[model samples]
Target: MMKDLQNKTIGVFFGGQNPEHEISIITGEFVIAELRKMGLKVIAVYIDKNGIWYSNKKISELKFFQKDYAKKLENLSSCYLDLTLSRNKLVLHCNKFLSRKKIDIDFVFPTFHGLYGEDGTIQGLTEFFHVPYAGCGVYASSVSIDKGLTKKLLSSLNIPTTDFIISYRHEFTSNDDSLIFKIKRKLTFPVFVKPARAGSSIGITKVKNADELKVALALAFHYDTKIIVENSVENIVDLTCAVLSDGSKIVTSDVQESVFGSSDLFDYSMKYLEDGGAQTGNAESNLIIPANISNKHTEKIKEYSKHIFKEIDASGTIRVDFLLNKKTGELYANEINTLPGTLYHHLWEKTGYQINEVLEKMLLQGYARWRESKEIHKDFKTDVLNNANQLKLQHHSE
Candidate 1:
């Protein structure tokens, strides 16, 4: 027990300057909603697209986000990024309101996705502030969000993944034909190219031939500087397995497959708010709960997901994606979402854990991590402050 966090203010942080800002809101609101249901005092921290922060009672409502809604937020309290050891507590920069109104966060649940939000910058702030928060620590969040880093780490661990290659903007700018030829030679046609540091299918493209590779690269490069090209999994079922960790052990969720629309390639729209208007099939997109896959495949995915979670030193929960080619039965682990969509509670809900229980579990995990850090000894006997004069004298003598 962290002693201070019991029934204290739990901040559900969401939104950022990333393209996934709206989706982040959806995820953040889910967490906030669940926390409220759990009887926890929750604070909704909204980071505007321009990086401005806000935490107000009205933020709890979903429609506060309608385009002309900026005016509605006029009454909401504004927050600023101090970039110091003060992430948990947002200081009221406005003097008049500073005295009476202050938001002190006892805990943080960062539901922000992509770029600065989930890329370890916010996690670093929480670490500096020494506050309990849910999701992976700084290091894990950093590696997991970076595609190149994740592939390297997973490859080093001897995990099976799709064949791929990286291309630098400089190389592409040079109009390197070898890049295309090399990709075609090593991997078959129908390649998957994505921005190395992006999420939510923002910059993912499936190319049918060498001609489309260039266009895909250009599109993906618009989102990220680095390019990760992988072999497309034809006739494959894309699955996501969410794993939760509490240090002692990690638990796995039943494998859930993504059922895309008519477009063989699942793009941004198919990902978030499926445009097919097929709500019935969406039920299939959800977790199968004790997935219908063979025990061998389930075990393999579960073990792989757990290993990736541990290899990344991931805390809280992480959703690891995988592609299993139906024809060949070849399994390749895809990217890991450090701050997975909606905390992936839907998958866990099948295990008798309600949204409230999920919130509590995540909170407990966050506090446990914070408490573990406190257990580490960092005291020093020497008085460096008092010895400043002696140090100056020694430097002068030297």
Candidate 2:
């Protein structure tokens, strides 16, 4: 399968009109490098924060974005996807007159982390073009991005998850007291307030008391319209496991426990800015693989990770987070990241697979899913359109 892909061109899409744009760029470059190592033709498709698409070979290099990168935009060509069903190509428009180039893309590998790109938007675009793409499909992407929706689905399936209450910006604005009352009635203090649709630990606040609740909600609302307030688990240990699938079988990676700082919170700084910043893939030492837990807990986490992946109809690779309560020895599903940072290759690496191997499996699974979708009868013979004139006449009579 890897050999078959070698001859095909894959578009590695990253960066977007998202808060996690910088992180996405890192993941994108990592993917491009690994794909090239496999002898695959790769195109770096970069979407700026303004939502403008650009293409340049230089984008494959991390240094190309540093030191006044905005000025470098002129060096890159503006590009857009030619979503015509028959032609899955990326159209690059150069600065020169009548200068347009089209690059045929056999597959799309999305390294986007949050919002516009990861929350079903980019996936939907590829689906419209009938193009095979990596990561979860529209349904899975949309559900997994919203923390509130994910918890609701998990609860429905009897999957244990932390208790959470959702608050909309409009509701909070209209009746702050009522919303606060509802939150206080349902959840206890020291709750974690988070932007429901945001990631990278951005716009998250660990509210310690009633006095801090309002401030936390405001911060969360600044990032997203909906906010989720989850009860903070006492003596919590943050554990994450990665899951990969080829549309037939599911595999779980070794569970890793994230060591937190004095704040006891895994915020944005802890995730991307701890070590040498986002450039160095964060601090490796902060993540302890084969987490310091019993065999039973590890197996349970692995089981839950696989179950969540399958239940959500997810494809490709994903990272599932769980909050372990050391005091009570209880585990609760925190959230699911359909497109985890750097595809959570670190966890998979510890699980006996290289980054290239993981990417290969994702691309193959995407192709398989696309092929299966094509088999479904989309052009069903129907008389509804044929009776248009009769239907119009009946409507006029009415």
Candidate 3:
């Protein structure tokens, strides 16, 4: 599969009209570098904050996203996938000369983090064109991206997740007192309020009492219409395990425990801004690989991670986070990240797979999934269309 990929052109898509756009760009750059190291041809596709797409070799450079990025975009061509083209040929149309406008791509590696890119929108676009892309498909992507939906699905599957109450912007606005009453009645204080669809902890607040509940909900609603208020695990340790597949066997990476700094929660600044940020490779210090937990907890985390991965019908790679209550020794599934930052290659690395190996496996799994989907009979024999006139005549006679 790796050898076959060398002969094909892979498009690395990153950035978007998302809060996690910068993080996605970093992931794209990392993946592109790894693919290129394996001698694969890579096309860097950058989606600006305004949701416009551009393709250029310079996009792979970090400097292109820095100062005066607008002027730099003038040198690049804005591109879009021409879905009207044949399935065998995925053509990326760009605003350039006719000869240079169409770029053929055999596969896609989406490095998007949140919102439109990670929440099944881009996955649906690729599925519409019948193009092979990395990470989970539409269903899994859609389910995993929304916190409220993800929790509901997991609860139905008998998976243990932190107790959460979902609130909508309209409902909260119309009856703020009712919503607040429900939260006060159902859950205890010191709850975590989060935007249902946002990632990278962009719009999250830790509410300690009723006085802070309304403010937290308002902040969350600023990012997304729906918000989830989950009961806080007082003595909790954040553990994450990544799951990956090579289209045959599934494996889980080593569990890593997140060590938070002065922040009450692992907010946006802690994730991307502290210690020179994730792009500079210094933020890794906050995560402890082979987390200082009992072997039982580690195995259970791995088991839950794999189970959730299969249950969601996810392909490629994913990371499942858990909140382990230190006092009770209970673990609650936090959320599933279909497209984890940098694909969580760091976890896989500790689990004995190189970054290149992880990329190869992801690409191979995506290709195999696409091939399997092609085998299903899409053209079902139906006479309804042909007999429409006869049916109409019969109805008129009756």
Best candidate, lDDT: 3
Models 1 onward score TM values of 0.87, 0.94, 0.94
Q: Which candidate is the best by TM-score?
A: 2
Q: Write the per-residue lDDT of candidate 1 for residues 37-142, one digit (tens) a residue.
A: 7677888888888888787777886777856667876766676645453654534342235454555777888999998889998888887778788878899988
What value does the lDDT take at residue 164 in candidate 2?
A: 91
User: Residue by residue across 1-398, what tens digits does model 3's lDDT show?
Assistant: 66767788898989999788889988889898888888899988889998888888788887778788888887777887676773754687888766457788888889998988898988887777788888899999999999999999889988899889998999889999899999999999889999999998888999999999888999999999999999998777988999999879999999988888566777677677888554223588887888999999999999999999999999889999899989999889999999988887767888899998888888999988888888988898888887679777889999
lDDT of 2 by residue, 187-216 (tens): 998799999999988999988888888888
Which scores greater on lDDT, model 1 or model 2? 2
Model 3, which residues run further than 4 Å from truth?
97-100, 278-281, 389-398
Candidates in descending lDDT order:
3, 2, 1
lDDT for position 108 in model 1:
82
- For candidate 2, the TM-score is 0.94
User: Each candidate's lDDT (Cα)?
Assistant: 0.78, 0.85, 0.86
Candidate 1: residue 365 Cα off by (Å) = 1.5
Worst 10 residues of 2 by lDDT: 85-94
Question: How would you order the candidates by TM-score, starting with the best?
Answer: 2, 3, 1
Q: Which stretches of candidate 2 lie over 4 Å from their true place?
A: 83-98, 277-282, 389-398
